[model samples]
Target: MNAQREKLRMMLTSAIFAAIIGILAQVTIPLPLVPITGQTLAVGLAATILGSKYGALSALLYMLLGAVGVPVFSGMSGGMGIIVGPTGGFIVSFIISAFVIGWYIEATKATVTHAFIANVIGMFINLFMGTAWLKVAASLSWPEAFAAGFLPFLIGGVIKALLSAWLGIEIRKRLASARLLPYSSSKRTA
Candidate 1:
């Protein structure tokens, strides 16, 4: 009974985090370049606290929701068109970024520095994928893509990484204390 309850709890946690990501996606700061959104920070938070697999699940669920025509994307947009659109790469990369961040956090000691490093790498991956797709989908030159998608967001990425790392570490501590995280569980059949 306890085992089943734990499993269900984890699933609910994943769903809650996915919903958080969806909600954060709507908090956009529109710009001429890539509009800033709270989505990445949410992704980082999920990954940092949940570790690789669950973190990826959260992000994947978010993308799936959007793909199925839910308005889970920035600016209250969604559907297949949004996924195939110019900035779709970044949206798609959230899964990869979360996975990478979670994997790193899981492998490491989960220190704040580790979270910061992992998140920084994830942000770079986002930038690369977003820029690459912007070039192809929009027929933009490399310079144009960089300017419009990557350059403008460099500072913001660093800020988000730092903030997410700090906040995620605190959240992880609280969740662990409440026996809500995977690592907080002492039993395993495997």
Candidate 2:
């Protein structure tokens, strides 16, 4: 009975986080290659709070929602065309980032510093994948891809990383205090 309850809780939590990701995705600044979005912060928050499995699950749900022609992506866009587009890689990277962030935080007992490090690592993954996808999908050279996709987002990525770190830590602490945490694997000795 307890196991079934936990599973249901995880499903509901992931679904809620996925919806948050979609809502935040709508907050964007349309750029040339990858548009700036509040998505990364939301992803980090989900991962940090939900732990790895549920966090990744949340991102997967968001991807599925976007793939099914829902406008849950940046600038209110979605569909198979968007997924295969130059910016699709960035969208795809969200799952990986959320998972990595949650895994790292869980491993580190969900420390603030670890959360920040995880966010940085996830940002780099996004940059690399998004840049590569932009290169191939848009037929741009490596330098052009970096210039249009990666470089422009570096500063903003750092800002988001910091913001995500702070927000995640605060939320985790609050949830911990409220005894609403660790229906995930984040039942740490911290």
Top-scoring candidate (TM-score):
2
Q: What is the model-wide C-alpha lDDT for candidate 1?
A: 0.85
The residue pairs that clash in candidate 1, if any, are: none
TM-score, one value per model: 0.93, 0.94
Q: What lDDT would each prediction earn against the true structure?
A: 0.85, 0.85
Model 2 Cα lDDT, one tens digit per residue, 1-190 = 9788778877898999999999999988888667889888888888888887888899899999999999999888889898899988988888898888888888787777788898999899888998999899999999899999999889989888888888888887878777666534656625
Off by over 4 Å in 2: none
For every candidate in turn, the CA RMSD to the true structure comes to 3.1, 1.4
**How high is the lDDT of residue 153 in model 2?**
89
Question: Which parts of model 1 have CA positions greater than 4 angstroms off?
Answer: 1-3, 184-190
